[model samples]
Target: MRRWLVLVSVAAALAGGCSQAQDASSIETTARDFFGAVSDEDGQRACALLSSDARESLETGGDSCDEEITKLRLEGGEAGRPEIWGEQARVRMGSDTVFLTRWASAWRITAAGCERRVGEPYDCEVEG
Candidate 1:
């Protein structure tokens, strides 16, 4: 019985790790798709990936999200490995850092075009 319990524990641990890896991969994919849309000048598609608050941030002063998002010209190179904690994740790219949050069953970009600031939270061009 003890041996069986040990085996079950090992299996559970492995499953948890695999689940985290899958979450990371999904976050990375979302990040890549967002950047790709931006690169392709598909503002509509890019806006679709953003969280509601983030999207709303772009729509100000009578400017729509699709119009304002492309105007900023956010740049992000190849996506690096993502770090995820709970429902939040951060993906670092060659030129930018993106922050995401799990919304329902999917991940959405809460902030993009972020830069590190000394003694302060990340400064993002697009943030919720």
Candidate 2:
């Protein structure tokens, strides 16, 4: 019974890990499309890449993804596409590391720092 329990636990761990990896890859693709849109400086198109809450925030909460993109563009602009892990991602933007994520196929910029977080700015930077 103990051996069976152990096997079950292992299987669960493996399944969960695989799911996380798939989510990460999906996030990576979303991030690529998002930053690609940003590189083009299309706020509306880029905003389309953001989650609905993020979009609402941008439209109503007085948040500023455009400015963030512009600042990133000025600070030498983004270095490369983000590498996502689970619901989080990291990107090098000149001298800064930009945090990112995917919310329903939309890419949201959630943080800007060296180390990465796991869960608001951690959850998405493109906050309200």
Candidate 3:
């Protein structure tokens, strides 16, 4: 989860956009698109939305990223309010929380299917 936090922080920092509305909208769009790709079973598209580290983590054990990612069977839900701070961002949906990082000019998913755990880092299904 430390890895997940770091990634979120990076993106949140970059999220210092011209306006809060724009930043939030961009972040929300990325989150929705990521989950949408997952729900569609379009592993290639879903993997494209991931941060480099996340893609690396998902492609472990000699499996191709597209193949392995599809197997995760992540659930998609309606996006809710996003919590943004510095360089980290967490967007909560009805069923999942997604962590994203800003890499260059785009936002990428660092973790997904996350749930808060008391006295612990988020328990995430997909993380870097």
Candidate 4:
């Protein structure tokens, strides 16, 4: 019985590790797609990847989300490994950092074009 319990514990640990890896991969993919859309000038596609609140934030100035997103000229390059915490995640790219939240079954960008400031919260070009 003790051996069986030990085996089960190991299996559970492995499973959790796998799940974390999967989540990280998904987060990176989402971040990359957002950057790709921005680089390709596909405003509609990029906007679709944003969280609802983020989309609304872009439109708060009476400008369309698509138009505003494009105008920001957000820059990103190869995505680094994502740091995930429950439903929230942060991915750093070459020139920018993006924050995301898992909504439903997909990851959506909550903030993009972020830069770290000493002793302050990240300043983002687009945030909800």
Candidate 5:
């Protein structure tokens, strides 16, 4: 079950629509860019893709916190394409896994209701 989820998530991340280029890689790329910005401590850029709560967390926690999040990389979850029709996205970077969302063919990081770990490698939430 987990493996299937991984496959689907990866497929979702890599594809998108341009009309919209819905393939898993497209979404993954969005996640990749977003993470890169965050790692660079570009909160404004990262926040642009983050959920409302994520934005709030960064606002309250400040630059240090945001930079920490940025450090995480978007690893796998690509079957060489992108697909839409989902509210969430997942990708792996090194030993890390990231969750993102879809807006048409565009992807953004999901921060609302997602549990964050301070000074730790993972900040994730299980979908209910």
Candidate 6:
């Protein structure tokens, strides 16, 4: 059920403009690095890979961004192909789906551990 939802949301996000890049390789690389950081339990590095908005979101409540991010228990695997549209991108791994947006010269994660909803947006564990 969740996989279906993520797929749908990814498809929906891709319906917008074409990817700004000639190919989505850069987006894939960014997603891979983000997940690798998480898997390695390098909270600071993971946080650095997020969009400012996502960083702010992670830092909400009483925890610092780095502390909060590590507490989420995120799991990731090798990334599959990426779907990018303009500044937005979706990358799927073996167990999770990540959403990213381009900011300045880099791609940053906007959401992770996202699951699709029947009539709403993807529900993400980490979202900006």
The lDDT per prediction is: 0.93, 0.58, 0.84, 0.93, 0.54, 0.83
* Candidate 3, poorest ten consecutive residues by summed lDDT: 14-23
The local distance difference test score of model 5 is 0.54
Q: Model 1 TM-score? A: 0.95
Model 5: per-residue Cα lDDT over 21-81, one tens digit each = 4446666676666656656677567667766555555543455435544554433232333
- Which stretches of candidate 6 lie above 4 Å from their native place? 1-23
Q: How much lDDT does candidate 1 score?
A: 0.93
C-alpha TM-score for every candidate: 0.95, 0.54, 0.82, 0.95, 0.50, 0.78
* lDDT ranking from best candidate downward: 1, 4, 3, 6, 2, 5
Question: Which pairs clash in the backbone of model 1?
Answer: none
Against the true structure, whose lDDT is highest?
1
- In the order shown, the candidates' Cα RMSDs to the true structure are 1.0, 6.0, 10.3, 1.0, 10.7, 11.1
Clashing residue pairs for model 2: 49-106, 109-125, 109-126, 110-124, 110-125, 110-126, 111-125, 119-123
How many residue pairs clash per model? Answer: 0, 8, 9, 0, 36, 0
Cα lDDT tens digits, model 2, 1-128, are 99999999999999997876666555555555666676777776666656555555545346465645433442324356557666667676555555666665545655433334566334334453
- RMSD (CA, Å), candidate 3 to true, equals 10.3
Candidate 4 residue 90 Cα shift, in angstroms, is 0.6
Give the alpha carbon lDDT tens digit for every residue of 1-128 in model 3: 99999999888877755456676788899998887888888889999998988888887788977888888857868888787775578899777899988787788889988888999999988898
TM-score pick, better of 2 and 5: 2
Candidate 5 displacement at residue 81 in angstroms: 8.9
CA lDDT of 103 in candidate 2?
61
- Residue 31, candidate 4: alpha-carbon lDDT: 89
Residues 1-128, candidate 6, lDDT per residue (tens digit)?
A: 99999999998778533444434777877778887888777889999999999999988788888888888867877788888776788988767889999888788899998877899988898999
